[model samples]
Target: MLNGLTDAGSYLQGVSTLQNRTVILSLNGNYMAAGDSYYDGLAALGICYEDYQKGGAWIFENGVPTLYLSGKEYSQKYPIKDGEIYVKSELHNEDCEDTELILNGKNYSFVENGLNILIYDQDTKQVIDHAGTDIYVSFEMIREEKGE
Candidate 1:
């Protein structure tokens, strides 16, 4: 009886995680969001896109789709559910071979090699929560915004 209850609890938890709309940022290539490095509009912000040494992977999952920076030694394990997934995100990085975001499934992630964000209007409620329905996934390929 206790075991059955525990299993049911797990099932419910999984459902909540799947249905919840959110963003998951999992970065693998060199990330340079901080002020230590500077960039200009004409020039590209240099990061680990080409020189990813291929030993480590970055994974971030709070309440959204899962992502993976797969390699020969390492691979990400996905869930079995729809929002949560199970199978193979299996791919090599730009360092080893060409990288593709998805082989199968909806592009709900809207993920890119650089950064992904959420955009929404402030009229409905001011600051929008991650789970709110008014948000849109915005992927910034390069840090070329005006005024730095």
Candidate 2:
């Protein structure tokens, strides 16, 4: 009887395949996959990758990715490249204000002077200013004028 019990235990342990071990490990937060059942639970709490593309912006609550533009979910995962421009909007006085911007994984700055707003390029450090008047300047335009 003792030998039979030992054999049963060994068999059960042998039946624990790598996939089963992985599933168990994932359940314990030791592993993670994109579409795993356990990952879905984490995603519900915003604990997934909130990646964006060259011209994309998103917000990550926990780890999930939420697009900043449309509030629609992304069907695929992406990474934000260097010098990527991301347009976002802000609401002031119950009115929506849209702005074109980019972040180089460094600093964040906003320039607003009277009716003019400026967006700075992280790479060239150039400024693009937009005035309520029909006058607007791209960062490249400013750099070209300055011979930078």
Candidate 3:
């Protein structure tokens, strides 16, 4: 049985089998996969990954991802799961049709921006109270044209 941690790398691991999930480790270097089971087992302990050198904690609670900044949980909204990641460049390359997002060769034509995305039913095409991220991208938010 492992006791309290004394170092960062003591609890972090780079495992190939986990794919996108952040692999954690027991104090004795046992690999722990990310999932609800681990969360349930460790939730009360606030099982956070602290970057002592950088000053922050990466948290995953109830399948919702968040960043603990300044001791507060700030949600990092992302809903894409279990699919091939399609970046903005690929969206451009595919010449994505207006109002249509093709993921895995299927059309998902509805989207609403929220902390997490809300993609609606395929047939109804109306925003449902759910979350999804078939298309994910990162870009700077600019208020005015550059070089103006």
Candidate 4:
């Protein structure tokens, strides 16, 4: 049985098969592949990869389609789950509608956009909230400028 983090290539292979995983790439828009420089630090853990995501999009990576950010602001909300909820999202640039963000949604849409991630376990109640690259964290954030 593969206990705690057997290796990096193994994890990537597993992620390729995961149904609910997200990469939020910024590649040339591969069928837009992508990557980030921060991941190189994983070498110390003995987990590494040959290629990495370097694009900007929240699309289905395993399939044959690409995704990109648009000029549309979005505002939606969801009640906290038992006063404890874990949400994860990846974003590179805020090309999402070049307009003034009105105060709305379960979160502050206009808040300073930065590298963010979160994960919580129901049983252990372990919370890992990260704003930047956390080797113990599994994520990659990318950005693409307009008129590139």
What C-alpha lDDT do the candidate models reach, one value each?
0.27, 0.25, 0.24, 0.26
Candidate 1 regions exceeding 4 Å error are: 1-19, 33-73, 83-113, 116-148
TM-score of each: 0.28, 0.20, 0.18, 0.26
TM-score of candidate 1 against the unseen true structure: 0.28
Clashes of each: 2, 6, 0, 16
| Candidate 3 C-alpha RMSD relative to the actual structure | 18.0
Query: Can you rank all candidates by lDDT, best first?
Result: 1, 4, 2, 3
Residues 1-148, model 2: lDDT tens digits: 1112122123222222112110100111111222232223333333334421111223332123333333211122223324443344333432223333334342221322101112333334443221111112221111112322
lDDT of 2: 0.25
Q: Using TM-score as the measure, name the better of candidate 1 and candidate 3.
A: 1
TM-score of 2: 0.20
**What is candidate 4's lDDT per residue for 15-118, written digit by digit as tens?**
33433222222112111112343344322222234332322222222322233333122222222324422122333454322212111122211213222222
Candidate 3: residue 64 lDDT (0-100): 37
Q: State the lDDT of candidate 1 residue by residue for 12-117, as single tens digits.
A: 2332333223222223233232311212210121224432233123322334324444332344444422333222223355443222222124222232232322
lDDT at residue 30 of model 1 (Cα atoms): 33
Instruction: Pick the TM-score winner.
Output: 1
Q: Quick one: RMSD of model 2?
A: 23.1
At residue 76, candidate 4 shows an lDDT of: 24
lDDT of 3 by residue, 1-148 (tens): 0113222222121111112232111110011221122232233334543432222223332233333332211222223344421211112222231222333344332322101111223333332222221212211111112232
